[model samples]
Target: MGWPYLGETLQLYSQDPNIFFSAKQKRYGEIFKTHILGYPCVMLTSPEATRFVLVSHAQLFKPSYPKSKEKMIGPHALFFHQGNYHSQLRKLVQSSLNLNSLHKLIPDMEAIAISALDSWAGREVINTFHEMKKLSFDVGILSVFGLLDESHRENLKENYCIVDKGYNSFPTNIPGTTYHRALLARKRLKQIMSEIIYEREEKKIMEKDLLGYFLNFKDEKGRVLSKDQISDNIIGVLFAAQDTTASVLTWILKYLHNDQKLLEAVTAEQKAIYEANEGGRRPLTWAQTRNMPLTYRVILESLRMASVISFTFREAVVDVEYNGYLIPKGWKVMPLFRNIHHNPEFFSDPLDFDPSRFEVAPKPNTFMPFGNGAHACPGNELAKLEILVLIHHLVTKFRWEVVGSQSGIEYGPFPVPQHGLPARFWKESNHHYRH
Candidate 1:
């Protein structure tokens, strides 16, 4: 069987996974050929092949895909940079998202999560996705950007969505187009950031937030980053930090709703922790989250089953030989994460939603929710903290039920519930109850 043209097939495959699974099985087997906007692309499904593309031979590949920049929040952001430029920018961004800094941000994260929970305590129905999205946005603004004003927070949330829609639109800046609107949105966001930057510079506010760190960051030449550079980097961090966390948390809640036994186990774990910290003197700490081994396993499992980023594309910067296949330069190589995650050889009953798959022996390099190699997501640790904290609060404070009795979820570019995930929330009447 040979490859097919990039038209209805690609669109259909992206929108509908059953069709994609069938195509992968019948047409291309494990590896397939396709095109994105008329560019040659090879989609590798096998774990070994994906590992080769993403990790082993990563240097030969670069994330230079045409839509990479546009699909991200803006051009020249961290996602699009290459080589030394990428390395340098990644270092500066890493300062704020590093382990120590992420630990410091946990107190702020808990406050945001708790505030959201308190607001929805007596509500009959709520959208967990929307709640989590707002929680994440608030955290990003407060912890990352050091912006705590209510009006500013609301404005950033609105502007961020517009920018996200713009990035997902086709890369065109024509009037009345999504991209055009995104440009306007970007300009608004930039203007806001410019004012913030100016104030920080003028007032010499030496706070500990991400913006503060960036303001003080200096290159090897002892030069501060330009205003445009600061704006681009800030946009990159905000985009990377916000939506990806929301998607993962949303999926975790969905999986917990579907599996009653798992949900019971997770809820029990939360109760144990809450009871242990009886005094309100200490909130759920980062160390405590780290101690929740079951929670971590569940998160990893959800990431494998409901991968937010379905496939990752890297352009072959040079001809490479892998497992006797000659991958020529300039070919767009896609690491088909869905296939690798569900491969029976690496994961037993790969289709089943089982967190125990990660309990015994780890699944090698096959499970890469944060991707692998040099260009891996820099905010991976922060994302994990966001998930753990949100889950902790939800499982401990309230109970939820999925709107439908569907067995599985639908796949968007990112996996989302086919029916909007509607759930009722209530305070746990019996706080000391055991599972």
Candidate 2:
């Protein structure tokens, strides 16, 4: 319906995507019909409409992804499941990653944070984006596949880079293309997972990592997940945890650097928590994540200002009408995350960075950095805790300042500091802050 079959696809890719969305919202208003990525789409930005599509009328829509991603993650991937299957997979994933059980993971999480920050201090300049991914990937590998040898874990991280690139690439299978390489990388990961699974089975060991749960648990059909399913879901978890969390962590660094006042306040909050524990350097606990209410507020505020995933896409399985507009069946229904996030109607002076706005909760469905409804991220708590732990350690132990002239953020899928957030970090030794 827009610009031939290409529709408004080029418009999206032409500039800062938020700029395009802002312009379109100014001209068309919210909930306008447009064509994107060769499909008819009805974009929803208001909280009511987002709630309608994501939760209220969710049954009328189904999750969809680009061909490149589907091929990369594979046909049996947990992401493709719906209804009961989706619920079952969600439970299995939650059993290990959810907040209620995260206490068991605090030791590993703290160790990862200390090691990463200590290493970063050795360098004259640390790139925020690269360092966050390394930490996030390390935590994911530790909690999800702790039994694997260090070499295999590094191999997994290496192939993950290729697979991630293909995620946003065009669906071309031609040799020398990123897509081809991504497919090849996926194959290598699968081979590694197969060998690991074989080794675990041969030893009759029932480990406690996410992979161990998948390797041993049976679904309602009374069947264990195949190695292919295990590998595909591992890909799902890794992809989910890696860049998204990294993006948040990178933004946290920039925010703290920009506001020394807020950093001091957050640091004081953590210092109390850190010194409160016996021996002063013990690992955090799951329940303790709630102790730093301000840190969580800053993280939430950052999410609102710049969401990692700009929109959530679903295909309408049936005609659905909202506020007198009809979204036809087979159309793509995209919930513009930022539109609602930055909406003046929902957030007063939405452009301002005010963590105190979250001093109280935003209206229901008004804030969903992690998305809402049935498809909400199961690992949301895990990601939050990881961020909290890292921020806690970094703030209490070191002081940082932005090193270069950053041009601000640019979106490649999600927003990132155009400069990669180069920063000079100093490890604190005095164990105290001066007012």
Candidate 3:
């Protein structure tokens, strides 16, 4: 703790958070106590400790977030709760992302990726992360609502962007503030969702989407999910899908850009699939997407390197002890994902961008990009599917060059390449597409 109440919040925010975390770990060992965001938190960096908190002893800790954030994303979201409600809501979400559902959405996901890449082609300079966000958002929508109308999609995107921008801003309801605008936008999102939900209910549509699962849900007590509950969970899933996936995609681009040989290898791997698909005339099969071992390793390495979620907050529901330390009830417990990922003990030469390292899996519990245990990201499968689709089309049909210095990282609450990795893209000539 730095100050009486302010704590080390300034120190954490004023510099690179990784640097702060590293410094603290060096001085205080793998487990240390620090106050952040007005809460006393115990930060655990070792894999055993992390596993204990997130997996084995998870019942003693409940998901926690700032009240302002809870309100911003809708308090009814599953991430803010545990127990029966969380379990039930999580099942509904999982039903929509299951393999059968994702298989049906593959064509739509590929279409979104192709359209996005085509639009970015020949651009002077586009922010790769922002463009990727659009692609991910479209896929997210497809997963949640099936084929939404254009007008509805546009409205949802506009409002959602406002809410996303304001999510990390200072929590002030004062007039003319970013957070205020965000709150208003969040309301608009809820209203828009209500209209969509009402339409589904009135039409009696029963499609195999997340909305369908929510619509058809009835609990043990025969209680149906409230409209507010459904809306919050949809928004929450979208929030989870967008930035985290986009950030990792951006890092993949930067890492490939820095290493010509690796880029060539990844492109070659994807090119084999392109040729087998009859020179880009065929859609990728689920099996083909599953077979790109080299590209898959790249994805795994990027996730490990980015560690976007970084650390998650879980409050001690009751006093708990681990490794001879006591966590008082109500204190926050954080498992430092980035630190664990970068620790040399787990990943040799951790700072190097080596996709090959993933050829052999890391020891159990050492690699958790989407978190661990029950509250892990539900849309993870869908996220990977969309990424594979995009990369398949991208490497086979387009070539891009970073437009600015590509060495810096920026955190808009998640680590992304500086300025979202400004880059220029052009279509790969038809000659290259020929067998």
Candidate 4:
């Protein structure tokens, strides 16, 4: 579908990715062949095709994170795990971050959201992407990870930024290259996490956060997980959940800002819910949060449009066929998530941001914001809760607008608000605010 060795790698990196994929779709059918990022890959765009790869033949695939990413995130990453080990890890995470346990996170989440909103109230402009990243990172570390990176913000954030940029970068071993920097950053984070692990263990300190669960969780053999494994998994959890959720939250704001009607409607819903809970704008219980159906739809539509993780790669462990296209063994297969998510056939007038479209669930395999099959994101509830809680506070309190030289979306590896979606934000005074 592309060049001899490089395939469509350069085209993907340079050109508008939608245009690139659209042009290729016209040339080849939905399930076509191409080589990119050092593999002869098959890109699945159709829902049926994606399902066959992700579900029908789930066991035949493994996560295809590049060599550089493997090094940075470590062997404990769910991407590198498979079979029983992967399932066990997911169960452990779900146990701690699930609905019941999630209630404990609400207060911290609300406090952080309020403090951040207050900070922005006096500011001239806020970068949506940057600000959300800080908010998400803070909540994740302080509330979710047992304050693991509570005091290591600069060091941890620097290393995470390096690793994230290197996720899709060329795997060059040269001293100045992105890959090299990412590797060095990975080393630093490992050292930092290792220290945190040891400190927690030696002190025998137990907090109700995910770190405590990880440290105390034992397998069938009654053996607790090692410090390195816990540390690596913590890094992986923060890496996977933090930025992507932040990106979605940023886009949610941008969309709400663009459509005043939607913003008002969502705000009305939040206001009603808060008033029902005695009108104090306090952190909500789990049931209270999910009770706002339209707010939930807004979250869903935002996820569909933003599609933070545009594509997920899996390595075919054996030869497979989809839509009569032979997918050879060992080839990398990527589910073109956004393509399907944005497909006109699946969503009427797909390009439009209409939260009402989510009123009715799409057909099977058609709406996969968190992916599908065995590898679907386990922390989906937590991610949604984070977004839900933050948005609850936002629409209930503030009115914001995009303000910058230009505003748009920069979608590739992740969808982010272009130019960081700088915006002017302010909320009513505390007395005038709902209380």
CA lDDT of each prediction against the hidden true structure: 0.75, 0.84, 0.90, 0.80
Flag clash pairs in model 2: none
lDDT of 3 by residue, 1-435 (tens): 889888998898777778999999999999999999899999999999989998998899999999889988899999999888999999989988898888888888888999999999987899999998998889889999999999999999999999999999999989789999999999999999999999988999999899999989998889998999999999999998899999988988888889989888888999998899898888888889889998898889999988988899999999998989999999999999999999999999999999999989899999999899998888888888888888888888999999868777788889888899999999987737343
For residue 213, model 1's alpha carbon misses the true position, in angstroms, by 2.7
State the displacement of the C-alpha of residue 213, model 3, in Å, after optimal TM-score superposition.
0.4
Task: Tell me the tens digit of each residue's lDDT in model 2 across 85-196.
Answer: 6777777788877554577788878889989988888579878898888899888887788646887888888888888888888778799899899999999989988888
> Which ranges of candidate 1 are over 4 A from the true structure?
1-15, 18-22, 25-27, 67-72, 279-281, 406-412
Tens digits of per-residue lDDT for model 1 on 1-435? 124555444564455564565466566587777666556778888777877877787788888656635444556676776777678788876877777777878788888888888887788677766776777778777666764667666777788888777775677757998877877888888788887778778988887777877788777788887777777877888877776777788888888887888888988787788888882247877679889888899999988887787788788999988777778899989887777777777888887999988888656677888877778888888788888887888887776677655444554346666544667777776665554
What TM value does model 3 have?
0.98
Q: Which stretches of candidate 3 lie over 4 Å from their true place?
A: 433-435
Please tell me which predicted candidate would have the highest TM-score against the true structure: 3
* Model 4 per-residue lDDT tens digits across residues 155-256: 787788888778777788899888888888888888887777788879899887787788888899898887678767877888778778889988898888
Report residue 341 deviation for candidate 1 (angstroms): 0.8
Tell me which residue pairs clash in candidate 3: none
Clashing residue pair totals per candidate (backbone < 3 A): 0, 0, 0, 0
Query: TM-score for all predictions?
Result: 0.91, 0.96, 0.98, 0.92
